[model samples]
Target: MTTHVYFDGGTKNGTTRIDPPFDGDLYFQAGLFDKEERYLRTDEIQVVDGVTYTVFRFTA
Candidate 1:
């Protein structure tokens, strides 16, 4: 059996913040992509209020 986990980007579960490197590393370790799969160049990474996040898209 194989288990796959993905960090959809942005916060985790709409509360705690999830950052790159950590999340990205997970994907890489899992044999996926090493970095964010898809995101907007214009948006890049943004810090709203006090939370930092990146807007990414999961394509099917």
Candidate 2:
């Protein structure tokens, strides 16, 4: 199964503090999900105080 994580950009430090706590290397399977769900990678994410956040693109 594939897991999707939502990030809150308004968090304190923004997207710069989510990897250290989860260890390094955020790996995923290519065919885990039938459709691609928007999510942020460890390197592309950050947390502030206790909030996490990320940036994403959406279709209109």
Candidate 3:
């Protein structure tokens, strides 16, 4: 499955933080940038239920 990730344009050092981190290579859409960001490699984050998630990092 392909998951879409949106960045806040707030980068620490070099790597930018993304919401709902996806496993492997996936689509990365920039929220506050003017450039094109089709995809990127990211860590996995999944939702388990309505109030629960596999990796509760971002508050999606």
Per-model lDDT: 0.34, 0.32, 0.35
What value does the lDDT take at residue 60 in candidate 2?
17
Scored against the true structure, residue 37 in model 1 reaches a CA lDDT of 44
Q: List candidate 1 stretches off by more than 4 Å.
A: 1-43
Summarize candidate 2's per-residue lDDT along 1-60 as a digit string, tens digits.
112233333231122322323422333222344343233344343344656444322211
Q: How close is candidate 2 to the true structure, as a TM-score?
A: 0.20
lDDT of 1 by residue, 1-60 (tens): 112232344332122234334334222212244433432212334455665555343332
Error of 3 at 6 (Å): 13
At residue 2, give the lDDT of candidate 2: 19
What ranges in model 3 sit over 4 Å off? 1-13, 42-60
After superposition on all C-alphas, the RMSD of every candidate to the true structure, in Å, is 10.5, 9.4, 8.7
